[model samples]
Target: MDISTDVWGQLALEASQVYLTEGGQVRSPFASTTIEKLPDKVLLNIFSYLTHREICRMATVCRRWRMVAYDTKLWTHVSLRPEISGLHVSSLESLLALISIRFGPSLRYIELPIELITHTVLHELAAKCPNLTHMLLDFSTAMQLHDFSEMQAFPTKLRYLCICLSEVIFMEGFMRKIYNFINGLEILHLIGTYEKVEEEEEEIYEVINVHKLKSATPNLRVINLYGINFVDDSHIDAFSSNCIQLECLAVNFCNKVTGSTMKTLFQRSRRLTCLLMNGCSLRSDYVMQVEWEKSSVQELDLTATDLSTECLIDMLTRIPNLRFLSAGQINGFNDSVLKAWVEAGTARNLVALDVDSSDNLSDEALHRFLSRHGSQLHGLVLGGMPHITDQLWQSVLQLLNNANDGRYYEIVKANFERADRTTVVRTSTNCRVSNYYLLSNYNDLIFN
Candidate 1:
């Protein structure tokens, strides 16, 4: 007889009784027997599915549960970010106390708000969390740092550091202070918030010297400087010359970066695979003149650039192993570009393509390209195309569905109601295909 359903209610009641009891004393003999049968490993595995708050609540269930719930593995990666952990800003002290008592040396990764990263806190983290290697500090609140010298106490073992700053005045000084501590850092991502000014003049951003960074972190492999206005061709040239093992470099929205830097990277950085330069001033002449012995670049994003049709086609021919290509908001991107890609066999290796806001493309060109490369493509974004009607979308969906061995593909659209409204559609598959339609002035979709 199957007793699974029959005993569930009774077991649940017994479990509740065990939790409510002062010392977690089991009221029923059956409950004690059942609870004892589950080993510590199994209990820990079960607790892994729960949130940090839920895990803390589970500790009240019984002594065995308390032991399992507080397992070091479950607390290795901790997020103190209020948005993610559902933690309040005022509860930071209590959270720090909990981390000191529970996480201790086991915390390998942590995400903290800038407000909580004080001099004392840094020293405490450095002393207590000896094994901590990855840290992400969110400064989106535009918190001001009193002293950069305090960062000398930051954990030295950190290999991955991501900081999100919002027009902070001491950006350069803050980076320099931490540079002394994180010499072994492999990945550094600096994300800056850019506020648009109504005037015609551009807002000047605080520049961090890339040459100094290159000297400090010699073994750097991945660097992403998003919306940092100071990045230019000199910075890219510095990385290309020094950081030989660099794999991925993204300087998206740094309008100062022109195609000259891209040309430098393509020719010098052989191991580079992903290069994102969206919202830069990439001139047609500079791009057309790019010559490389053999570019290892596979993923490239040139969204909102000034590249003409001929230059784009020529650039595509250079990167033979290209898999992901995003050329959104290019006026010169038309049916001829798609036709050229298909003709040159460049569309064969493409797994994802984003041609959003390219007004000149028609249904015929898209349908033709998809018909040939639909099987290989797992992601396709075609937003803001007036030519692609609802009927065309349905036909494309049908074509994609039929191409993938009769597998059903559904479109999930999420509409955000704001000044800049966005509608995103994704497919329900192992691979996600996102098509973001912006009903606002912003032309480029920010991909996280």
Candidate 2:
């Protein structure tokens, strides 16, 4: 009595149905009636991944989710969208009312586009979000005609602040208002918002002392001035004296800053860790040779500065602890100079080296350096280096293949390197990475 395959399958299905009927009444609840038992902790972790807008939408899902979302910890990050409805209203009262109702006391961090943040709303947020530690306010246009004195009355808990006050008129009292308040600041980024049109030189100079940040935020550790036009070096001197603990200093498009003044200011801050001078027309041969505290500086970014190999050697030798070096457009190094740096192992401890568009580097020089240091290198951002032709990538693969004989090495190459390397690789000409991590990796590239 052998059963056919079809007959056996039918019998098994029938048996399963009979067993289900006899054992459990075979009643399937509606799909909506059943509640899935997902762990609350897992849900919370998922919620953390959502953006502020996404979180706001999720809050309206159900009572339980809404209550959970209302948790103060979850609202610590608030990203205000400029395109959101009811944001463009010029009236402060209506805007405040909407914000207060939608978001309670849970706001800790707020990022607003310059156009959307009304002066009154900014003051109201300052008063409401006492626990605020980070605030990024981008105002790409002229400062509105409103009083910011109310900001002084708000909490001074901000530690990280990035404000683009370019073109904004700062009255005489503005400096006092900021100095009296925002004393707890540690990181300050004051970028001047300048338009292409030429304005009165006096007005440009007038904007300089508008908000004397050095006097206000004495505890500042980092200060970056972008699009800032200063007639003299007095502001830098003031900052050097006041922000004595400064670690990172960036001066971009400050054509008025003399090389001597910059070098002198660099000597003032003992804790200066990173210095960036981009788009400056300093043609001095000795600018790069200026000595700095080697162990203190971990990062140096000199993009679009007119520097030659002579300057490069000066910088490399002086800053021994430099792990990251972005010498963008600093041409003039030939194979000999590169060979010298490689032989001296100046970049042995570096993590990232971005010498893009530099005319000095040659294919042979790059090949020799990567061949020696590629094993320890994690990130290599050498774009626009004329030497990085197809032949150079072949050299890279050959070099890595030679190094991978039982030993371990991790290397991430950018657009310059070929994709066939056996080592763990990430390639791009403009490799996007965090500023801190880039510095750290470069430090490792040099030191490791």
Candidate 3:
């Protein structure tokens, strides 16, 4: 190995040297010596497979493990998603302090549990983990916070930011600072927020205004906003004009955004790679698939919206690179559209296809679609297609069983990702509902 490799190896050994332990719960030092003497690189590899919780447990086994658990390399991808119950709120501050200091600059990715995030915590992260990049903050339970001073110190390296906030006040308050501080921000996703009614009440909400934020995040590539009632086509026009390099846009469950603005978005954001507008009040004529014929969007989800069957089919046939398509609750997204794609050979490239809740699709259409392209598909959401019978899943399993091709397993695995680090899947001999999960060994299913 080269000199750089040697240095890394030596660091790992110094970081995990086994020492005597007082805990009777741990295996005797001499007993585990064989495992401990392994090369430092191998030991690091073993630690890499462990989650934050598992590492915490391992740290208790021995003095040497405690050191290894705190190693900077092992703290890069951390999750603060654990729910803290029955403990004083001060415990959260302690935990955050420990993580920020011990993890150091190595921490890059973090996912905070809903309502647990606070202005103080974000500041701590920015100061301690200067290399932090991606952060997923859930605001479902987050307290109403309107401070933006700490956010001004946001880590310079921060890029992708997905904040699911609960208050419109907090959402609009932070955007101004986000653009100013997080200059490198690429993806800004703001989900629906809440407000109060009546002037007498302390709680009330106004529409989110991001018009001023354009000056800060001029290079933003992806924008996802949901339920901003005050926004109209003019806001979309301004965003399209300002964020000229936008590649992905998703807006859902909103009324102010008209179909005309969506058309302008489609036309202005020419480099867009993904578009999702679920429940946006877009006129049928404005969002015709023909408008997107020459566009570069690869992933499109227009759930709960209408597009002509002919338009759906035409878009599928025309967009050879479209890899992810979902039309849930949309009319004219029947088996015929799938057939048209199959005949055109464009469905072969699709990684995820969701026609869920499309009542018109029959079992025959799904069977033909799956048989022709099942092996290639990584995700298939088949729920709500009533015409498809239980026998359809059985036959799908049988096909995979006969050929041993593994598509059936892939579909099941794609359907749901296990949330916990340690997941024990138990498959039964007879299941009431079966679409793709018929594997004999549930534990053997590999997660992507």
Candidate 4:
């Protein structure tokens, strides 16, 4: 009475067929699990991962998808910049139409090009977008406006505002208009274009009186003034004294600023964590004279500055929580500086280190530093170092590889040139290295 293997298989197939079919028609188990049957919330979550153009295309699929694609939540943060949006919106009328139709009350943050920012546009944004809180206007173009009275129509609810302006003569009036309007601003970034001038000459434009701004925006938390040559000690003193809640301040490429202001900021701004003073003339005696305090500053960028090694080492001793340090292109950043910081236990919390163009750093000093601290670093920039040989570079890489636990650390950017006799290495995670080159003086190297 025992059944054969073929006979048992046939019987089992017939039994499965009986359950897989009803009314003599075969049916799939997933027939009821179609995409159209998905909940609107799930569909919106899926659409959130799509680009603006892709979301628009998905709208043409079905009625339900159209509704989900056009959800106001999906259009909260919109970038009208041509380079970012990938849509060349030519006219103000078209931009206005898009705002009124697509991104009305749902708009929370927007980046608008300077050309699109007009009186009517500002008025429309204020009237239509009640939830708008962050706005960035790029004025890096050639278009100049003599009057910025239209800024008075800006949304009062804005907390973060960034204005990228080129070298314009009407900075005073423009800034006055902005300060008068956005009194409740918390984060303000005023970026200006950097122009090369002769050493003895100066580019004199109407200076922005930041002292007035500090009074106007009392709730300021973060201020980044890049390439603004007019910002001096008085301006920074105003912000340091008034903006007590300031957390981050960047005055990169502002040559007019010196170490006097740095002392003021450190003493006054107790909550400051990030201080970026790249390309500023911090070579003054005031930098060495200040009494270093145990401050909360975490990220310090002294790139292309003129800080003496003693000053830098003394400063590092005070910053116990210092995580990111950029000391590139500084003449005094030699092995002694590295050794001093490491010995003083200042490099314990350093997660990112940049020593690019520090011509004085030796291979031995770099190798020792990396051997001790390279494993925990998420970012390391060692570009423009002619002193570091290929052998030492390989040892540094080996140390990092052994410590990374088989996880791939991406070489975000690695540029090598035999002409300059320099190697640039920038490392992070989640990207693949593309190109590799061998110089005549250096061995074949591939960063992973």
Candidate 5:
């Protein structure tokens, strides 16, 4: 090794030795040795795998290790869980200070659970982490927050933001801030927000004016909004007009979205790719899928919607590139329509298919759907299809193997991921669902 390498080794050994020799102390495994004696980069590698809490603890162990742990890459991803206690306002400020001082520019992600995070902390974090790209904040209060105006000049480089607020007042300010500040954001997810209703004795139709929200964001690609209530059609209309560049849009459990209004958005936004409309009351007389001049939408998710399967299929076939599809819990989409979807137009590109929670599809229907298209299909989600047995799942896997080249078959339940060049499968006992997870050279399957 070079002199620089040897020097670092010596420093680590001496540091380790000091810790062991301190006090009438109980001797550790390396009581007489020092960190300097160990491989210089070995500890660095160990730091990479540790959680933020573990890394913070290790930073205080010794001066030599502190320097190594202070590497900017160590603080690239930050997770603030509600369950992990001992974080007060002051502590949060101090932690932010430390993080900013040590690795400001490299910071990317921040996760705080819904119940624990306060508005004060949110403001502080927004102020400090200017280069923040991804954030998940769950605020349980109904208070209207100040403009995240502090982040205006910092960097609107945010790509993904997931916010779960309990009250509409909180969203009013938050949305205003986002409209005023982060104009170039790509993917935005808003969930679980209550509406701001009138408490007075005389209250009529409420009009929420979101004209301030008309600014355009050309780069925004995916938008997922769920479990929120909007007062009227205009509010919903204003929100949709902002994200003209949307590709994948998911709005679940939203009470204010009308089917006609939704159809209007589909007509206007030409670049939409994947559309997920779940748990919404789209009880229109008839949902007519509007034709777009430059329709590029491929995947369509109509889980728990009121649209009939025939109506959905009629609307879907309009998009030429239609591929992966999910229609769970749509009582209207019967066996014939699904099988037809699996076999006909652009279905060859249909790699993943989910039909969970549908009382309409039976075992025979599912078997026919899978068996016919099993060769082309890579992922099949049959959750809440209580009629499907383990026997059927096994047959589907076997057929996929027979159809494709001799690639190893992999089964994933609950969640699955791809890392480096390998496939990782993790099963959860939360529910028994039939999934046609396979080992492919492509993307992973994630369900939440």
Candidate 6:
């Protein structure tokens, strides 16, 4: 895909005094009229590209500018985060108050830190922004409040949620209420509650029923959970029964989820296209014995998980439509796997790969893998293989060079070419790390 013009438009507006450059006409190098003389539509277009902080700063310029800056389209998608460490609560309250008045009713997507999940603020949000769809909470801060009965009070149309709460909080009627109320929720991202509770509370902490959560979100297509430990056999069964439309299931560091649950998910969710499991102790037998479904999984990520060689090959063998594969350090994920992949002709169809930090993989194996698969690859990550030399990196570069030939890939190719020139040799790794991948802008495509 082309580097979106929207992204370029934002960057240009931020750094340059831009104009409509759609024609061959070239105007004077300087402007005769001030920004105040610009039309409202033009000003709105510029304001739409700015972030909340920049808009706030721009609003302080002049009354005419401030009036123009308040366009509803410009404030629809609001993203806020802490600017500095140890911020005072009063500053946050003041900011929220300002946002309520300034952005009122037009908001669609809001991403904020966990510190801002206040009841009053959420209630205000629910009242004002009824059309909100996505809300992401950065889980760096410990959430102090519970009672997200307030979430029902946040936004009725809120379908995408990313929150990291303690398991105790999940048990205490937050998720159940959310699932019950927000039936339209398609994406529920739980950023694993890995933070330890007080020593006293850990002893008494009890597990809650996750089946209720599954029952509540029947329409869910994506459930990405991190550091979660509550998912079990019952939860899996509930999901299998209820969430048939689910396409993406990502569980990272969730030790409680067994391989049997995974197999059930694979068998049941017919539309399931992506399976991402990281740091889970999934048994090889249950994982390898997955039965077929209508929607063949196209993306598989086993990074940082305990996957053996036999299980890995079996999964690849069974899942025929896989175009993306991300794996971490697995023993015997060297020439043997590469040979099997190439021989099976599975290597030719792959679109992306992220096999970082393999201790045993040689340059010859990667060469064969890439020669077979490189034509189709849009993204690749081979960082930390000890055997790959400088000459081998060049060979790998030559192998995927054809990926640069197309209108959609021009900007990507340019960026890659620029990186090749601007690269400073790093002695630590013995090669510029950027050599491992093209289209750095497409990192998200590698796993999703």
Q: Identify the candidate with maximal TM-score.
A: 1
The Cα error of candidate 4 at residue 102, in Å, is: 2.9
Residue 15 lDDT in model 1? 56
TM-score of 3: 0.68
RMSD, model 3, all Cα superposed? 10.6
lDDT of 6: 0.64
RMSD of 1: 8.0
Between prediction 3 and prediction 6, which has the larger lDDT?
A: 3
Model 5, range 42-108, lDDT digits (tens) per residue?
A: 8888789887667778889888788878887777766655354322324556665655586477778
The per-residue C-alpha lDDT of model 6 at residue 269 equals: 85
Clashes of each: 0, 18, 4, 0, 11, 1
User: Runs in model 2 with CA error above 4 Å?
Assistant: 1-44, 60-65, 83-91, 98-105, 113-123, 149-152, 194-211, 229-233, 285-289, 293-295, 397-436, 440-448
Better of 5 and 6 by TM-score: 6
RMSD of each: 8.0, 8.3, 10.6, 10.1, 9.4, 8.0
Q: What does candidate 4's lDDT look like per residue over 136-230, in tens digits?
A: 87776735763556555768899888877666535566666556678888888877777756677655673456678788888887888888867
TM-scores for candidates 1 onward, in order: 0.78, 0.75, 0.68, 0.76, 0.71, 0.76
In terms of lDDT, the best-performing candidate is: 4
Q: Tell me model 4's lDDT, rounded to 2 decimals.
A: 0.73
Per-residue lDDT value at 33 in model 3: 45
- Writing each residue's lDDT as its tens digit, candidate 2 over 1-448 gives 5467787665556545522465666633332232224556666777888765666678898887876665566667665544542123355575587456645566766766655555567667766776777776665555554565554454468887776664646545444555566888887777765344565565454454623667778888777776676533556677887887888776667666556566666677878777766666566554753566334777777777766667666667666666767766666655666677776667777766666665667777788888887766555655544446656765675555433453333333333254454543454544433233555323211100
Error of 6 at 207 (Å): 7.3
Pairs clashing within candidate 3:
115-141, 115-142, 196-203, 196-204
